[model samples]
Target chain A: MDCSFENEIHLEQLMPLIEEYLAQGKPVKFSPRGISMLPMLRQGVDSVILESYKGVPRKYDIPLYRRDDGCFVLHRVVKVGKTYTCIGDNQFNLEHGIRHDQIIAIVTGFYRGTKYYSVNNMGYLLYSRIWHCSRGIRHFCGRCLAGIRRRLR
Target chain B: MKIKDGYIVREVAGTTVVLPTGDDLDLTKMIKLNDTGKFLWQELQQDTDEDRLVAALLREYSVDEATARAGVQRFVNKLKDNGLLI
Candidate 1:
């Protein structure tokens, strides 16, 4: 079946619908747009499976959270405290003071092309750890790569 | 007729998206409805019949009775074909 739509829904509106589905104890799957969670997730390419989070998010776990500005961000937890500090995988800055109630769901898995990678998968786990550790180096490499791609263009 | 259970309508961008919830997630079908289709779908949700739906379309939109009837028939048929009608 053809299962696609060309609608650009706001995060505020979509969150309620996603929460409703998760409230029913069902995983919600949808393609997220943005370059924030780069490398791991691609805009218009990857689809994520989200389940309602139960406890505090650990370091390196990606959670879908809402900011005070009513914007939803799917970013990795960098620090866990009374309030979690998060940073997008592709971002250089850290977003601090995210509350527990602000977290809507945790990404359990994601589909890249036809292959599905679970958060529990050993390869994904290893990659997550390595990616988190090497952010500085990756950031530099990403800039270099972008320059090269621009030159090619 | 009513829209079947497990289906939720959302407005995305400027388009209407009908998403199936719960176990119906596997359906993976994101149905996009036009303005008229969205109006009709909302009417269907409130214990509406084909006649009432046509009346609503005629009342809300600047369409003639014949056009409204034909539009309602086409819309209902499309919903039936997609197994969205109950």
Candidate 2:
């Protein structure tokens, strides 16, 4: 049945429910509303499957971590050491000093339309590596593309 | 027929919603059910057919057999269309 919500539910309010399900070993799937993980994940279009992370997040792994401001960010781990540094695929700024406790879950896979792409897929791994390596250039090109789109509008 | 696995029924913001989880995560569409629909869905969790559903509706509501049958048919059709029934 075509169900529409008259009011939007905030992510903070939904996190507890999501956690409860995950605690029961159930994977939570929902359409993430953001433009941060662009190219790989489209806003309001792609849906992701989030499962409770078992171990420490490694570099190139996209983990959903809660920030000190209480906002959950699904970003790629760029560096792993005493602290994890995460940066969105579509952004230039890197988020540093994230601890393991702040991380909620890691993305197992995601659905693009009806097709499912696992995080461990060879092509996805290659793309993530390349994307992570060329963040500066991608950021510049993304800005240029956005400017062009705005001008066109 | 039975309601498939990997679907969770939750009450979100005063709305009863059926969301696909696990392997069915690709299903982006959320199904919202009313009080009656929710009850019927719970019943359908076990093995049930249209006649049994219609009978349950008759037992619960004061509707006639024909009306109950039609309602059950419509509900079953909606679930089938959404690939919710197995």
Candidate 3:
């Protein structure tokens, strides 16, 4: 079966298999194709390991959820009470009132090449915290001065 | 050589995708095994050699010795390059 080729598969067709793997308590690994969680996750570079989400996702946890119209998304939770308020790291708008049932899996860790970083890693925690905390200013500046400086430097 | 542990063969949208459970290997590589690759992967699940692989392929497909040997060699080299074989 060594005749391997690259092919693009729709997420809708792939999500069920991922969910099945997660439900078996197995962490599914794949390279997510999107720019929503950009900087942290690239379109075709970084790979993420996901496990089935158990309960309410806490603040800052990245969960793969489906929108009512059948759109799938991966975003960070900002507010969690009866419902969740999530926004992508690369986007400004807050998506409100997402119920727990809507969430499929939570990112446990990720990799850049062979380097793996856990969600609980101090550096990752700091990065996510700073990114989310500075979202307000970043959104206001429409691309903050600090971010530009960091990129430039 | 044998196929490394933690790799699984799954079909998605008519493509046979390879996913790894082991994190130690490079996670950035997305592997899609073609039909021949899939068959040899099954053969490599256990300890095997080049001759054995070529023989297996010959038995399975209506191909000549040179073709089967070349296919096995190429696939083996690819697996080795990707660290999919131990």
Per-residue alpha-carbon lDDT of model 3 for B1-86, expressed as tens digits?
89999877878677677776553222245576778888988999999999999999989998999988888988888888778899
Tell me the spans in candidate 1 whose CA falls farther than 4 Å from its real position: A1-6, A141-153, B1-16, B21-28, B32-34, B39-60, B63-86
Best candidate (score: lDDT)? 3
Number of clashes in every candidate structure? 1, 0, 12
**Which candidate, 2 or 3, has the higher TM-score?**
3
Model 1 earns a TM-score of 0.68
Ranking by DockQ: 3, 1, 2
Whole-model lDDT for model 3 versus the true structure?
A: 0.82
Kindly report the fnat of each predicted structure, to 2 decimals.
0.14, 0.08, 0.36
Judge candidate 2 at residue B78 and give its lDDT: 76
Output per-candidate TM-scores for chain A, rounded to 2 decimals.
0.85, 0.86, 0.86
Listed per prediction, chain B TM-scores read 0.89, 0.88, 0.90
lDDT tens per residue, model 2, A1-153: 211221234567567567876787777777777898888889777888898899888899988889999988999999999999999887889899999999998899988877899999899999999989898887788789999999999
Candidate 2: lDDT of A8? 36
Put down candidate 1 lDDT per residue, A14-59, tens digits, no spaces: 5555777789888878777889888888887788888889877899
lDDT (Cα) of model 1 = 0.80
Highest DockQ model number: 3
